[model samples]
Target: MQNPKMLIVEDCPAQQLFAGQLLKQLKIQHISYASDGELALELLKQQRADVMLIDLEMPQMNGVELLRSIAKQQLCQAVIITSAKDPLLLNAVATMAEADGLQVLGSLAKPLNKELLSLCLSRRKAEVWPADFERKAPAFDQKLLRKAISEQLFSLCYQPIADMNSGQIIAVEALARWSQPELGMVRPDVFIAAAEQWGLINELTLLLLEQALQQLQQWHDLGVVVQLSFNLSPLSLSDVAFMQQLQHKVQQAGIKPELICFEVTETQDFTQLSAAIEALANLRLAGFGIAIDDYGTGFANAQQLSRIPATRLKLDRSLTDGVSERPQQRLVLENTIQLAHKLGLTLIAEGVEKLADAMVIKRCGINLVQGYLYHKPLTANDCTAVLCNSSEQQAAS
Candidate 1:
């Protein structure tokens, strides 16, 4: 693949020179320079850049305005925010860029290092072309979604969460999958988002929850005592009656509530905070474990954590992917693990694909981990087979 076309938007002449030299040293041929957001916008109108390196403190048009324009006009495919200002300000800008539907490569503190810059550039160059189905998937509507629910087209795949110390499976997170006859397989992200948009989130969530409970019961019958964790929509939390019904169904299925954990996405806004807190509090009271999913990805403040009563905190994959290689990330992960422990919460590091990364998490005192390093999401039968094999191995030993 050809190198990505890049634009550097910085007002400082010396910084621009430094960046230009570095890009040339890296053998990147197509590079453009803009002193401010206005010039950047003008350059973008002439030709689109695949990636943009933005300095937030530019004079004419600040990085914030440039980012807004980029999001409004869909200018660059990816962004790298570079700032020497407050880390909080840098993070706020990056978060804003992401919220505006732009792929932020990451933030870079001023005086960017060659290695980090190369890594960011490499990621831009390595993006895969969209698959045919992804490019052509039909827009889903409420009628079709309702039909999907009624036809039971949704299925569950479980990814094992393991004890980092023992390296034994402790729990499995149930991820939803949807297979439409016409669409082939729709990604859970796609369907789940659509479900939420169409006010079908509650129905879809309960369906997956029921399926997970049934499978957990089956595993129990086979003497495989593994806990199952599944996501709960924020919309579902507003309905007290629905939560009550969920508890009743779990009791009716002869499944212990302790065998299941409901993961609440941190990315969602709790418009009904009190109701959500009460709903989750009730679930925990009834013996269910609650986890704050994608913990570091969202804007949830410390105050929110105190109200939710979460039993576990699942670190987002972004923080876990290369914690060993990145000092800043390692520090953050270490601090997060420390905070979780202080709050009496279990810490599960997700997206631990590399052994080196796993080692880093283990060193940081996180005992639970989930990622492709252990197992990818598996069908119920395959997961059961894994459990049975583990049981056999233990018995033989």
Candidate 2:
């Protein structure tokens, strides 16, 4: 992070000079400039920089194309997109770059302020966060997969979800982790998809559920009472009998039904609509909460979402990552929160890594937030230790 070198790709000489001056004031002397992304790409091939300043409206090659090439070629340490264009467009471009597994520092609107630029520069992550937990996962076989599930080798970690107004952790969402033999940790997306294809999702789901509920009971006994959100596969959600399996487990663990919330991703289309709805309704009837996860992204429209009887709505990270920088996006989030309130759903903004993001979500009148800003996914022992610390503090007070 020291003496951070940067590349500025801009067609306008005056704009480039202004950015250069800002960097110079910041003490970034090792800087280079190019009139277009093509030239910038060529410069990067010659020598890469710690960060690249990209202009969206370049002539020869656009910023988006340059981003794709950089990601494919592994050029530069990171990127900060500068455009006088609409902030919404900037957000979309940032999303595009992140989707390609390229780390984006921040999107700066035109006539950029020095302080904002400085803030973005200071956010250079030492180790890049994976683009939505995706990777080229190691190959898995059905035999090995089934053996892992049966042996309970697949593990669970909990990410704390905080109540922003109170700054207290109100809930935790359970995420699965798997360390395949010899191959190390396998990405959840890959192994989960494999489980679904191999017709073993139910087995895997029950395995994690049992573990989560047992952990929740331990936390409750420690007076670290917080809600537990567990993701359910559609394959398990459609089977009404799955409700009974969950209920029996809850009873055995002695965790109240009200403390458990089942989360279903809205990004994927619900093909088994009727059965899934029936299961959800029954679960709600039994006092278990339902949350529409990843609400803004994918196939779940308002009409479809409204039909599901959800008790909570999780705004997808796509909508919140740059919420503080994008006024229009904040307006959208505020209206979405309004809609969720009218339907009696508690709202949570996910992937809140910056204080600015938390401020914007707080301004939007949503209280709950979840992401690396608060905590990463942690193992049961690690999480329970945090709970113990909080409990001791409360007792001391």
lDDT of 2 by residue, 1-397 (tens): 6777799998899999999999888889899999998899889999988899889998989888888888877777588999998877988898888777767888998887789888888878766444533355438689999999989998899998877765667788999999976778888888998888788998899999988988898887777888899998877777767668878888888888899999987445367888888888988998999988888775655775568989999888877887887777788788888888888888888898889888989888888999998888888999888767765765676
Record all residue pairs in model 1 with backbone atoms less than 3 Å apart, i.e. clashing. none
Candidate 1 C-alpha lDDT tens digits along 212-298: 888998888898898889888887798988888888888988888888899987445568888888999999998999998887775
Name the runs in model 1 displaced over 4 angstroms: 84-88, 98-106, 128-138, 181-190, 193-199, 218-223, 238-241, 265-278, 297-299, 317-336, 351-360, 372-375, 381-397
Provide backbone clash counts, one per model: 0, 0
Give each model's whole-structure lDDT. 0.83, 0.84
Candidate 1, run of 10 with poorest lDDT: 128-137
- Per lDDT, the best of the predicted structures is 2
